[model samples]
Target: MGDDGPAARPNILVIMFDQLTPGALGCYGNRVTHAPTIDRLAREGVVFDAAYSNSPLCTPARYCMMTGRLPSATRGYDNAAYLPSTIPTMAHYARAGGYRTVLDGKMHFVGPDQLHGFEERRTTDIYPADFGWTPDWLRPDERIDWWFHNMDSVTRAGVAEVTNQLLFDDEVGHQGVRALHDLARDDDPRPWLLVVSFTHPHDPYVTRGRYWDLYEGADIPLPEISAADVPLDPHTARLRRVSAMDEVRINPDDVRNARRAYYGNISYLDEWTARLTATLGALGVADDTVVMLLADHGDMLGERGLWYKMNFFEGSARVPLIVHAPKRFSPKRVAAPVSLVDVLPTVTDLVGAAAPAPVDPLAGRSLIDLCAGDPTVEREVVGEYMGEGAIAPIVMIRRGDLKYVHSPVDPDQLYDLAVDPHERVNLAADSAWSAQVKAFREQVDRDWDMDALHTDVLADQARRRLVDSALRTGRVTPWEYTPPADGSGQYMRNHLDLNEVERTARFPR
Candidate 1:
């Protein structure tokens, strides 16, 4: 270990998974799934039990992690919104400090400059390619293209099937391994920051033959829920719509199968994580690299009869955060609540790089001090989720054993996590804690205003409408809406029109 006085610099590898919850991991007391790789990493490093995503969605959470600010702070609050290029990213800071940065897998960035702060983007992401909003142009040998053209063929053949007919997790794992191998051989002498993102356990829960067979006979446990449960917020109602569970009558078998598939996907992802860790060790940089394993968000998987994410529930908000710093940092478990916004500052601290001034006075604190076992830091964390449609906004604050959820269009939700960890009971109407509920409401108002929080909602709607109109009209005309420079405008103007033409030609109307 370098001298403890602050000159130490360590290479950083951030491995992020999509829609992975902490309770699904073997290391987090999940007996159903065997996540040996993640378990080993936890044993070697610090495991944060209460780590959370700032927003319970992919693009927003990633934007927050990249900027060290909450999604609401940057006005990038939804999946459809783009991250403004004006913000400085940790990658840019590392590059300024003479480090070589490369990003592989999915960044989920919308716009023309998909590279964001990274010096090199090694793979074409699944987000831009799959979504018709972006251009059809793809790199010759992009990993996403490889999946679409090759791995998907295996999926179509049904040789590898899991929950929702998704691709095998090993396929993504192999891709990450290949990327790491290339990074290890790069001629750059400067320390490197490599980001490997995996789209496993997210959806279409399909896995390879062996992985599927591993969980074939295992009975997947259902999420804890009560028959009397009802959404206390409009945001939760919106989530119910997406999950297709708002109907009064539903098929129980379908729900059970979906949950089983989700768990199977999680187990498959665990195996791939194991492979990723082994590949890192084989590359000889394991000891010198600070490996952080986390998720963009989590899946509901039938929690309260929900299938997807984007609610303020603990099942969707809480995520897995494992940080394996080289032997210099003490290894232990941290029970404090930590937000994804802390990622950027934490990485900067580890590499001894200068963090830029706060854009919105960050709601997160660096985990570096926590890693060193600081006792003065607060254990409370706050999170927010804004509905994309007509539903009212929701804000959640978790402090110690209490959780407060405020919704503009519905009754407030208060849960004593220590007493009701599953959130089966709601104590808002009880006369005893009316004072506590009022205080929580006041705190929410002081921290944020639901009406004023949605600064970019209209702008986002305008951009989406512009793109959709272009796709429909097949003509690029100037509009009141301006597209993000990351080439989204040009892509929308060119590719979406072509798609419309193809569709019209394929099926004349």
Candidate 2:
């Protein structure tokens, strides 16, 4: 961090939660665990009621949020698709606009170029960084057993003092607190952007006693449609087989316990958010920082018998987003549909980055436009699925009150969300809604070239599989991010003056 008069530039804090659905949060109308901190955030910030992931899988969703590009545009089709280093990210924009960017948790980047554009990233990502999770689109019936999620993660969910995810998130919180302390130093003059990503509430749904107790005796709701009554469409049936959902039976108690733990995990993250905001206030950086709260994607969490994300359904594709900056932006709820890809231009607009070239096809628009009490023009939000459960491209378009899902091989699903909130009925074949379906289908045709997309997906899959096999042969090195250490220059050193180091490290002058 260098330069001068940086206090005029606002600091940006992005709080990213993993796989926590908006419908489970207290602010979003859940009666499960009481999440006062996050609820308070919604009270003071602009909460987006319709925020969706461009692609629901971890790697592709995160890439969408980072670069403000759709998965189709970037060829980010699956979890193992490597993010090309050539693309400029939100971090790159921030750097161009003179900000110190840092990442503290799971970004799920699956390539050799791990950092993307962030100057420092504290914790290693939870998933593999190579092409290990690549899906074989060639073999639709063959399930990739090792990485494909099963019902075990759902049935085995319960309380835990310390699970693998708990340990990782705890360290993420620790590093985040430390990063705050580091940011508060007067010696560092550049405005900083700290992205504290937590891998929680994602899977193996477990929580500590403190959070678990918060949901005790509370009414934890079950999925809208149980597995017994699960309406299996052609695409959903494919998802069930790939996930091995038919192998296990989830009793009422198991569903209750799992939902209870998932709610508890949301509360657990609330405590973390409360502590971080308190830290910002303690460091006297609250007024100069604009905080954003969101998730990469949402979990189905047994919703409609779907356990994980990869579908266009509301439970899996929609995420919670709250932007809080009372000093600069007013508080108001926005019902307009937006995407994670919007985050890039929103951030770049806030920080005044070097603008993208005129020909750049970016899907993101500045959220600042919404802050000025302007009317929200009706717009369409598009999402796609080229991941594990599909042999062909699955595309989704949400416009106004209708949601249309198109799978190349399967029959399309059309739902008027205003009338059917649960997405129980598909109007694609209904004679009454034939005109609406026809209109959406026409737009789908205009938006995508299905034949070309299918070819591209298979080509990328074959290329990645070959590369993965070759890399596994001999002297194989993981592409996992190993953070560079700052040892001698920090704390104490035999050759340097300790007092000078202490003074420079001290915060608040």
Specify the highest-TM-score model's number.
Answer: 2
Residue 408, candidate 1: how far off, in angstroms?
Answer: 1.6
lDDT for residue 169 in candidate 2, whole number 0-100 = 91
Supply every candidate's count of residue pairs whose N, Cα or C atoms clash at under 3 angstroms: 6, 0
The candidate 2 region of ten consecutive residues with least summed lDDT is 1-10
Candidate maximizing lDDT: 2
**lDDT per residue (tens digit) for residues 203-239 in model 2:** 8878888888987788778788765564679888888
Cα RMSD for candidates in order: 11.6, 2.4
lDDT of the candidates, in the order given: 0.67, 0.86
